[model samples]
Structures are given as C-alpha cells and as structure tokens.
Target: MAIGKLFIGRKVRELRLEHDATQSQFAERLGISLSYLNQIENNQRPVSAAVLLALADKYGLDIAELSTGETDRLMSALTEALGDPLFESYSPTLQELKLIAQNAPGFARALVSCHQAYRRNSEQLASLDDRLGRAAALEATPYDEVRDFFHYVDNYVQELDTTAEALALKLGLQGGDGQPILTDYLDSQFSVRVVHGPSAMNAVRRYDPAGRVLTLNPYAPAETRTFQMAVQVAQLYASEAVENIVRQAGFRSEEAGEVCRIGLHNYFAGALLMPYQGFLKTARDLRHDIELLAARFGTSLEQVCHRLSTLQRPGMKGIPIFFARIDRAGNITKRHSATKLQFARFGAACPLWNAHQAFETPGRFIRQLAETPDGARYLCLATHVSKGVGGFRTQRSSHALALGCEISYASAFVYADDLNVTDKSAFEPIGISCRICERSNCASRAVPPLRRSISVDHNVRETTPYQLS
Candidate 1:
C-alpha cells in the first residue's frame, strides 16, 4: 500500500502561532527558507519527512497531534451541514472540504454551529405551529444546551475525571469489591447508613440528607444498586467540585446548569467506579470485551460501554468509540462520541443501525461492519438491556445500547474477531438520519433527502417511493 503525502501545513502554522513566533523565525528554526515555509503554511506543498523531524526536534511536538482526528470530525460535520436544502445548489469536492477543514477549522466549526442553531429554531417553530402556542418562550432546551457543551468539549472533562480518580484513590477504591468500599466510605465519611428499601419506593436510589440515610431499591440489580450508591456518594462529597465545574460551563439557564451539575456528578460517579488506569488496562487485557469487563468490575454492560467512551485522558487514550442508547421507538435517549460519528440531535437514529435490531434479539449481541454515508467504517456492537421492577405489575424500561469504533481499531474488539474488516462487501451502509442521508437507492428511507430533489413517477415505482433527481 502506498502512503499518502501528509498536508498538515495548517497544523504547522497553528503550532508556530502557539509559540508566538513569526513565519520567518519559525522557518529559520525548522532550517527552511521563508518562501518554502509560506508554501507549506498555505498548503501548496506537502509536509515532508525532514520538516516533520525538524518539528519534533525543535518544538518537542508530538507529531501524532498533527493528524489528530479533529479534521475528520470537522469534515463530517461540514458535510452534514452542507447537506441542508439551503446548500443544495453548491456541492464542493472532498478535497475542497478537506482543505477548508484543515486550513480554516474555526470557520468550519462556526458553520456547523450556525447550522445546528438553525435546525433548533426550525424545529421549535414547527412544534409551536403544531401545539398552537404551548410554549411561552423560544429558548434552547436544557438537553440541547448540555449536549452542546459536551459536544464542544469532545465528550471529555479532564478536570472532573482527574478529581474523580483522586477521590477513588482516597477512598481505597482500587481493585476489589467496589460496592462494599463505597458503602463503607459513605458510612465512615458522612455518617450515612446504606440500606435496601422496598421495591414499592419506585426509585433506584433515594437519599435523605437530613436523616443521613441512603436507600436503594432491593429489586434493582446489584450493579444498579452499586452505581446508585456511587452517585449518592458523589452528591455528598463531590458536590462542591461538581458545582465548580458546572459554573465554568457558562450555561445560559439555571435549569441547564442544574442538569449539567447532575450530569457531572454522574460522570464523577462512573469515573470513580471505573478508575481510568485500571479500567484501560483491563479493557486492553480483555481485548475490549464488554461482558468480561462488566463481570470483572461488577458493573453493567451499558456502564462498561459508556466508560469505554470516556477513556480519552490526554496521552493515555483508549480507542475512540461512539456510544448510544435508544428506546424501542428508535429515540436516542443518550449519545456521546469520541469518534467522527455524531447522532441526530432532534430525531430518531437511522433504521439500518444494528442498535435498533438489538431490541428484537434480546440477550444476543449484534456485531456489524457498518459504514456511514461519509464512507467511514466501524465495527458496531449492540445489545438489548432491560431494567425491570421486581413485582409482576410493575413496568420495565428496555433500551438498546450501541457501541462502536472506527474500523482501524477493529483488531482491538472481540466482536470483530470472525470478520474480515478489509472486505468491502461485509460492511453494511448506515446513516445518521434519513433526512440528512445522501443515499439515493435506500429501500428503508422514510423521508426524502434535503439536498436532493425527489421524482415521483406514477408508472415506475422503485424500492423507495421517490427517485432522486
């Protein structure tokens, strides 16, 4: 296989600017002429091996950062944004999009942000018309605000993860028996008693601060009980830290702030449960096996998958994966990505995703070599997870959990063991949503693509109702 030339002139210029050095000075440091450096900065020339070595030698730069997956993420976002009906007439080439993403990342991100805001406003107006003035204000929803915050930060909060790890260490939550350690920590530190409450309480965990009593529903699974206890511990001991982080988020509304605070507390709880170093090592040793890791850590499968997505701690990073939880109606209730895959913010996910099929096949794992419309490939794993109340008359909530990473990391996943990742025929084509999908011949498309005109021929009906014109 031939290696492609690396055109990271924009990254070079970014590094130069970060060091506050002019082009001439930086070029001199790299032992290159000012004219040559200018050519590279403008992306007229590829970054040579000599320049790469010079960059490392002089600046001590991690050359890997030059190709950090940010450009791919930006390109995907830009492509989705440009797929809007408003940009139907303009179709830029892939090279042009790549150039824009690499050389003008801020502009690319701003375009994505603007498109998101437009979509939010459009949805609000549509809902308002349907409800006939039900809402009193046209403000951003709390979910949208918090989702945007995490999206902007690439779904990783470094300070919070660090604090949680330190807290875990202080409480001696290293290897064995997480639940007991947590229970003892609560009792010893806060004088709180941990007790199992009746199933009729209809809550997983409830804490009475005044009485210093924490109760967990006995019907809940052991993993759920332990997680609830961890969450309560975070609330009692890490409230100030969580509040400080939430304050720094600069949320627009008090409701959003509170919601974000609760979210951060949950994040701290997960981090404390699965401390980064131990979890990463275990994941690697298990070949990223979800069930084995879950049993080893005494956590649920969903918890292990979610924790894997958050293993993005600077130099000690794990495989970048996207995690999503979807209900039977195909509504995505929880979503985060450390990869280029982003979920549709307002609607259900693509029907072709294996996650939806997981609901039909309970207690079975669905493995897929899936490709998005952007041509990116991933090894997708999905399974159904059900949470039920103990009694017969009580309700149960069933959801499908999806976890995946780019195909380049397929070797690290146990689910990909029997598959040949390089075989193009094995990959199933999927999309983020039908409205934004560009596939013209999709049989399951419920809606016409926004960027393409639809032709409805009365005489000739295809797999889909309409043909792309």
Candidate 2:
C-alpha cells in the first residue's frame, strides 16, 4: 500500500474548475508560467506565500482555509463534541491533533465531518435533558449572560432609533453622505470640533470646543460617523434625556451606567442614518440584499445586520435573523440575534454553515440549510466584509458576518429564493447544541456529554458508548 501525499493539488485544480477558467487563463491571471502553474497544481512544487496571496486575492479563497486547511474548523467541532468532562484528559492530544492538521489535511477534514456527527448526537441527548433542572443551569452560562444583555440593549436600540429619527428629521438631514455635513452641523451648533486620535493619543473621535473644528479620522465608517454624531447629540442635545433613561435602568455602578449610555448613543446614531420605518421598508423592498441595503443607507454590512436583528416590533416584525461576526479561526467576537438560535458559548461552530464557508468566497453571498439536534432547521446566509481603523495606507483585517433563520422563514429572504432548496435531503444538517446530541454511532466524538450514561455490552460492542433508541 502507498502512502497518500499531503499536497492540495485536487483542491487547487477544483478551484480553477469551479471558476470555469482554463489552465492557461489561471496561469496568466496568477502571473505564472503555464508549466510552473501546472507543476504547482500537480503538487510537484509547493505554493509560495506570494502565490497563495494572489490566489486568495484573485480567486477569493479564504486565507484561513488556504493556510490552515480545516484544522481550526475541525478543532471547533471536536471541542463541541467533547462536551463531556471525561475528555478533559485528552485535551493535550487534541492540541497536537490540530498541529498534525498542517501535515495531514485529509485527516483534518475527515475529523471535522466526523466530529460534526458526534456533536449532532450529543445535542439530541441534551434536548432530552432540557426538561429537567438542567434548563436553569443551561440558561445561566456565560452565553446566556451576554444574550440577555443584548436583548436588553435591543430595547434601547428601539428607543434611540425613535428619538434619533426625530432629531434627524428636525435637522433636515434626510439624504446624501451626511457625515461631513453632520460634523459641520455639530461644530457650528455645539461650539465643539470632532477630533480623531489614536486610543493612546487621548481621543477617539473627540469633541474639542477649543479647536472649533470636528476632526474625524478617515478610517471611521459611515455608521461610525453617525454614531459619533449621535453621541454628540446625546451629550449636548439630549444629555438630560439620556441620563433619565439610564436612571430608570437602575445600574449598580456609574461605570455600567456610562457604558449603557454610550451604547444607547450608538444605537441612536444607527437610527439617524437608517430610521426604523425607512430602513425596514427598504430591507423588505430589497428582500434583504445586505449590499444594496448598506449602499442605500450608507452603512456597513455589520450595521445592516444589526439593524435587521432589531426589526422585532410585534406584528410588523421581519423574519428574525441572528448575526454573528467571526474571524477565520472560527472565533465569534460579536453576536446579536432576534431568533432563538443560540451561539456556541465557547468553541467553534459547525463547519457546514454558510458562515464558515463565507471565508471561501469573500464578497459573494453563500446560503445553506442548518439543522439542530432537536430537528430544527434554519436558512443561513453569510458574507465577508472588511474595515480599517486607519486610512487606505494602514493595515486592515477582513471579518465575516453570518445571518440566518428557521427554514419556515426562508420565503421571506431573497437569498433563499436563489438557493437549490428542492432537495431537502441534500441540505446539510447542523446544530447549535454542543452537549445534548446522542448520535452515539459517530467516531469523531471528542467526549460524551455529561448527561449521557455509558452502557457496556461486552459481547455486543458498539461504535460509541452511548445508544439512543
């Protein structure tokens, strides 16, 4: 028997085929000789960093996938599958397994898929346990802590939107790129200039009454501009009003109150740019085309998702979408959702979701159907967006945002209409539950969840310890 090579020739070849480009065309586009490109594709030559970057920039391959393969993604699935404390002893080996991913790419991918199956089973078991006292314990985790925080903050978003819209209306700043003009309005009306400086440089978009000119960093997004404007409005125009709201929240500390105050100010700013009624109308009209909505409202992709999550106004609520921002390593940094979908408290998400795939085709929209252990399915859509904290000359990183909902709500999204949804079986089944699945037949399980009991039948051996009938 021959040992298989670790080279990624097939994937490279597949990329070219997927884009419908000939070898010569790909070689020319990559600025490499046809023979050399052929050699690289054949695994005769390894791809260099320059070539890898070119491929990523040209073909839009996810940098993480191009570099780490699926090791990180697999690690996430494995971590979730090992929800049981019994696997704690194998943690070091798991770390080593990740390093091995660089050398054994095929094995890494296989582990990811296998781990996904294990997670599904664990989640199933967890669902059964949800009826017990476990529900309270589950609700008290760090994950729910943040989620409840966001839920409370969402109400603040609604109030701020209403107030900010009224303010924007009064100022007669309804359309066009309003940042500069809004800055000017603040300088003229409030006797303060907005100045931008490094976090260490004293102020981040600060108002300087002495300078008399609002100096904004070019790195700020349109939404940031609006946010800054709203902060200024709260400080100057609605200081008493903002204070009043904070007072009602009954925070134990001044710091918490201040944090909530600043957050509310930001909510107000988003509303100024995208007033609730108008933004929701456009979102519905465009069928939730994020790019179109971003352009029409002069906001960022994140801002659009954030706004979408807030369309939960009783009978007029839009199809609830959960928003999560994750890096290439599958680490979710920020999350907001109107739907019941709960993000992983700690560890990586399912590799099958569109969010994970967004890293592959940077700018394009990808959609998929995801299933939880409870047999709940959702339609997910994800895309990548980039932002900078400095000018064009400064370094910037790209981030991905994934938004999705239950499959029943698919008819409300334009992205769902464009997907191949006729074959329900073909749609990948995924889960948000990390510890309750009972598909004990999976080999990729890192650890059995704490709730499952292992049954031993020496004469009748099973693939996994736990059995669900």
Candidate 3:
C-alpha cells in the first residue's frame, strides 16, 4: 500500500508548546521560515524533509509517530457528521474538514460531540415513552460516554494490554491451560480461593474483594466460568494498570469511571486469554476462523469475535476488522470499527445488512458482499451466538455478531472463500442509517431522510413514496 504524506501538525504544535517556543523561534530552530512553519503547523503543507531531519536531529523525535491515524479517523467521522442535514447550510468542503481535523482537532472533536448530542436528543424526541422518562438527561449517559471513549481510541488500551500479556506469560508457569490455569494462578499468587457451588446462584460470577474469594456459577459454561475467573484475576492482579488508565480517561461521572474500570478489567482478561503475538500468529495461520480460534484459545465464539476487533496493537495489527453485536430488536449493544465502515450512533443499522439475517438461521454463518452508499465494499460475516446456564427456567442471552474487513482484505478471511466479491450484482447495498442516507430509492427505508425536500405522490410510487429532490 502506498503511504500518504506525513502531517504531524498537531504533534509539532504539542512539541513547540512543551518547549514554550513561539512560532518564529520554533521555525528558526527547525531551519524554516515563520510562514513555512505556520503552514506546516496548520497542516496547510506536509512537513518537509528538511524539517523532518531538523526535528530528528534537534528534538530526537520519532518520525513514525507522524502518521495521520487519528486525524484520518477524525476526518472520516467529521465528514459523516457534516453530512447530516442539520449542517446542510454550513456544509464545508473536504479541504475545510481536513484543516479542521489537523489544525484544530479539539474543535473538530467538539463539533462531533455536539452533533452526537443533537442526534441523541432528536432520537429521544422521536420516542414519546423514552422522552418522558429520559428527558431530564439529554446529555450522553455513562455507557455512551465509555463507548465513544473506546471508539475514538481505536478500542485498544496499550498499557493494560501489555500488562495482561505479561500476566499471561507469567501464568503459563505450570504449562496448563483454560480456567484451571487461571484458578491455579489466583490460588497460588494471591492466596485466593476459587469456589463453585449451588449457593453461588443467579449471577454468573461474584467476587468478594475483602475476603479474597471468587465464586463462579456452577451452571455456567466452562468458557464463561473461565472468562469470569480471568476478569477477577485482572481486577486483582492488574489493579495499578487499570487505575492508571481510568484516571487518564477522566470521565464525567463516578458511574462512568466505574464502568470504564470494569471495561478495562474485561479488556485485560481478553488479552490475557489470548496474548497478542501468539494469537495474531494463529489467526493468520487459520485465516481467522472464529470457531477454530475460540477452541484453540479456550474461549467462546463471542469472546473470539470481540478479541479480533481489539487486535489494534500498533506495528502488529491484525486485519482491520469492524465488529458489532446487535440484539433481536436491532439495537447495537456493542460496536467498534478498525475499518472505514462506522455504525450509526443512535439507530439500528440498515435493513439490508446480513447480520440481521443471522437470527433466522441460528448456528450458521452468513457471508455477505455489501456495498455501502459511499461505495465502500466489505466482505461481511455474521453469526448468531447464544449463552445460557442450562435450565429451562434459567435466563439465556442471545445476540448476533458481525465481523468483517474491507473487500481488499477478504482473502485473509476463511468465510470469504466462496463469496463473489467482484460480482457487482452479488453485493447488496447498505447504509449507515436511513435518516442520513443519500440513497432515496432504497426499497427498505424505514423513514424519510431528515430535512430533505421530499414530495409524496399518492398516485405514483417508485420504491419509496417520498421522492428526494
């Protein structure tokens, strides 16, 4: 792949501020004129080779850190946000969006956040029951805040992941695997007791911090038990790392902090179960077969799918996959994308998506060739996953998981082997949501596009009754 030019304007500005240098002073130090330095700082021009050498020589900066990973993601998201009809009058050009993303990233982020708050408020107003109940809390809830935190960070927590990987290696002392290994680690390392009994009812797992005892539900699956144990182990063993990350997150409320703390622990547990390097090697070897990966790593199918999405370790990233889990009501409970295909922030996904069909054929994998309205093609794979404790009276959780990479990387996925990726006719059209969709003639649009000039003709209808101007 041909790499684009480096734009480290934000990094350069940060460095300049760290040294408390004016633009002129910084430019002089970098052997550049003030105007040229101004252009570079504003991302009007890419950092020149001379400037790069000057930075390396004078400041000992890492040139690799100049990549526009976060800026590109922000530009993409900001572009999508501007596409909403609410900004139609103020629709900026592509160049303007890039400048906003590179030069004033904080402002760009604020705009995106404001747009999210607007959409959330709009959605709430559309539902009377919810509006009546949640009208007081118009701002984002704790869960939404945490989800965005994960989304903007690319869903990878480096400090905790490395800590968990080290813990995994340390736990492999006795050479055993799965829950037995985790239980043994807890018992030997912390003088903790892992117990399963009929008394540890309803809840899947419970930990008594003061007593240093972990209780697992006897009825839960072995994988579930193992995962819970790993989570508890993470809470106990990786407390320092988790606390450091939580403090850095700086959530608005104590509830969000608590939620993030738990989430970090879960992330740690997942990383421990499937250490980075070993899991990546096996994933490439098996072509990312979720079932086989689950069995090999002693995890559930859902865990493997979720873990695949978090393989965003810099310099050793797995395939750029987008993962989402949706309920029967089409509510996306969990979502993260390493690819360009971002999900809708407030509503259900497009009806044409293959993930929705997974519920119809449980236990079967559904492979799809889908083209979004923006012309991006994806080789998507979806499957239904259900978990229960075993009794008819017991509760069971069921959701469909969708995982995929871009069509260009489909060769890395085993599920895409039989897919007709190149056949334009084989690809179904999808959109982020109908409200912002540019496709007016879509057969499955649930509602009309917001603020669009539409004429509904009772006598004639073409796919949809409301025709877009």
RMSD (Å) of each candidate, 1 decimal: 24.0, 16.7, 22.6
TM-score each candidate.
Answer: 0.70, 0.62, 0.71
Candidate 1 matches the true fold with a TM-score of 0.70
How far off is residue 145 in model 3, in Å? 0.3
lDDT of 3 by residue, 7-61 (tens): 7788888889988999999999988899998888778788867788899888888
lDDT of 2 by residue, 313-353 (tens): 66677777788888888777777666666665445665546
**Model 2: CA > 4 A from native:** 1-147, 152-156, 173-175, 194-204, 209-213, 221-223, 252-254, 391-398, 436-446, 454-469
Model 2, C-alpha of 368: deviation from truth (Å): 0.9
Q: Relative to the unseen true structure, what is the C-alpha lDDT of residue 374 in candidate 3, on a scale of 0 to 100?
A: 78
lDDT of each: 0.83, 0.66, 0.83
